[model samples]
Target: MVTFQFIPFQEIENLGSAKRVNKLLNIVKENKIVLMEGRLKKQEEADLIEITMEEISPKFKGIELSVVYPNKSKQDFGQKVKGTFANLLLGDRQGMTIIGPASVVKRIEQNPNKIELFTKEAKTPPAKRYRKKK
Candidate 1:
């Protein structure tokens, strides 16, 4: 029912990220996902730093991509939750992907049936606080 797009880091870099923030801003789309890899580069040696989408918003506003954190929606998405990340890593997960909550994303994948989204929904929201008894 929901429609969204997923973009990669390479495509974003090509768009002329006047400042890294500019590139991050351009990719912010509703229910969309961003696949990225970030490592700190230094003149001599580089260290990999795992950065979350929330850290990319130099301005720290939602910047179109909403952030969802666990058990908290009291503050803005960008402020509290950090960018919503999928629990199951997709593709080269050591890298990262940005996306909406699973329900919207479930619709984006191929041959989506109620079975997929419903299955996750049935198990998650209620379990946010306590693990459901087996």
Candidate 2:
């Protein structure tokens, strides 16, 4: 079965960049999808990918990550200013971040209005059979 873990922004707000990335990676490695409250900084995202690459193996393939944030291009000047102030004061808690194990999460697709997460089918090993000996 697929599992999802929700991490609140406050949980990682105080963690260092490395720690935050590690925390997310650890979860993904366990085949669990992480639904993070807010997006990571660009630098942090890059670091996460770099680290993930280094840790890739036969069992731990990698991670599928995506961030869904609001589009500010169409916002008015006043709204943009308010958003900037909010971000400055409340940190970058404006979007959702999704991180999942690459083995389980095939791909993540996003559109302006929605997101689609495709997952791989779970394979079950065949049961062993025993025969009586004479």
Candidate 3:
């Protein structure tokens, strides 16, 4: 069975750019998809891409990153108001960021409403056959 690794925004928020990238790189190297709770800063994201690209070699696959934007519609009054205040304090809205191996992530659909990663079906061993005595 395939499993995903989830990293909360708060966990990496205090970390420096280099440390953050290193942490992310380590996770992706394990062939696991990372579902990050919040978006990465522009500079942090760029640095990550640059460092990751340089690390890519014949044996290593680079990462694919995608952002999941938040929906403003359909929220109740309390939620909408809270979101607005948070945005004002934070300067912008935060979204989910997906990071994974390029080979595996290439098959994922990056839609804001629905993000999907398509993994290969598990294989089963064939049954053994025996011939009756002739």
Candidate 4:
């Protein structure tokens, strides 16, 4: 069995509107993988959250966990499924998290034909111009 933590992006509401955008930026820096909904709250607040894996809960049917980066948070009932996640935390700012348990992972792994990765070697850049003298 497996369990997952559900993180919503609207928790920043409590922070007030002025720092909403700033808070979102900070969250991006902290978590490597995150799904952000660009929409702001009524008071104009963005929702940003990070998801991490954990041990399965026998009482729970699917992964249903909630965590607050600072204050407290709560989730609704009956919303957890099983599946696999291949870099579920893709660097994309807007996207839904696909939850899959062991079965899904195994099936994809065993498939003969699979999607190939498309990427090329990255190039390094030179230092920027600077003028600091006395």
Candidate 5:
């Protein structure tokens, strides 16, 4: 089973960038993938990278951080008009940010409509061969 920790952006919205970075780091050290609603602030992202680099070691692998950006599509004229107004008000639809150890997280891919997570296998079972007798 896949397990992850979740942090709502609103939880850290009021905190300073440094505090946000620290909170994220502490949770990520527990070695579970984190799914955060809304992206991290620019300053917080930068600070997180800097701090992670400083603390990196041979055994302690670094984190894989990624954002799944909102996608806007144009199809119908009426829908387009509505979307434009929504964009003006909301800026952009908030997307998810994932952070976790590179060892476990593996890779993250962002597509127009979805975020794909690829993780390392915890254990692999040996392959079995089946034979059909004629």
Candidate 6:
């Protein structure tokens, strides 16, 4: 069965960058998809990918990550200014981040209107046939 875990920004707001990345990675390693409240800083995102690569193994195939944020191109000047101020004061809590294990999540696609997350189907072992012996 597939599992999803929601992580609020407040939950990791106080954590160091490494801790935050590790926390998310740990969840992903468990084969659960993580829906995070905010996007990580650019550097932190890189670090997460780097760490994931290093941890790739037979049991841990790595992660699929994506971030979705508002598009500012169509926003008015005043709206942009307000958004900047809000980000400055409240941290970068404007977007959503998704992290899932590669073994489960096949891919993640994002567009201005929506996000599509495709997951890999579970592979069940074949049943064994038995015959009576004389």
Give Cα-based local distance difference scores for all models: 0.33, 0.93, 0.78, 0.30, 0.77, 0.92
Global CA lDDT computed for model 5 = 0.77
Q: Given candidate 5, what's the lDDT at residue 75?
A: 52
Question: What's the TM-score of every candidate structure?
Answer: 0.25, 0.87, 0.72, 0.24, 0.72, 0.88
Q: Lowest summed-lDDT stretch of 10 residues in model 5?
A: 86-95
Q: Per-residue lDDT of 1-134 in model 5, one digit per residue for the tens?
A: 46698898778878888888888887877777888877786777888999988778886578888877545553577877776786576542366789987778888887666777888888767888889988
Candidate 3, which segments miss by more than 4 Å at Cα?
Answer: 71-82, 89-93, 120-134
Candidate 2 lDDT trough over 10 residues, lowest sum: 86-95
In candidate 1, clashing pairs total: 1
In candidate 6, stretches whose alpha carbon ends up further than 4 angstroms from where it belongs are: 124-134
Question: How do the residues 39-127 of candidate 6 rate in per-residue lDDT, one tens digit apiece?
Answer: 89999999998999999999999899999887889789999999899889877677889999999999999888889999998898899
Candidates in descending TM-score order: 6, 2, 3, 5, 1, 4
Name the runs in model 4 displaced over 4 angstroms: 1-10, 41-134
Model 5, position 48, has a per-residue lDDT of 91
lDDT of 2 by residue, 4-47 (tens): 99999999999999999999999888889999998999999999
By TM-score, how accurate is candidate 5?
0.72
Supply the global lDDT for candidate 1. 0.33
As for candidate 4, its clashing pairs are 9-47, 9-48, 41-45, 83-100, 83-101, 84-100
Best by lDDT: 2
Q: Rank the candidates by lDDT, best first.
A: 2, 6, 3, 5, 1, 4
Q: How would you encode candidate 4's per-residue C-alpha lDDT over 4-123 as one tens digit per residue?
A: 233354454355555654554333333222233323432332122222122223421222111112111232232211111211442122323322232212221212333222222334
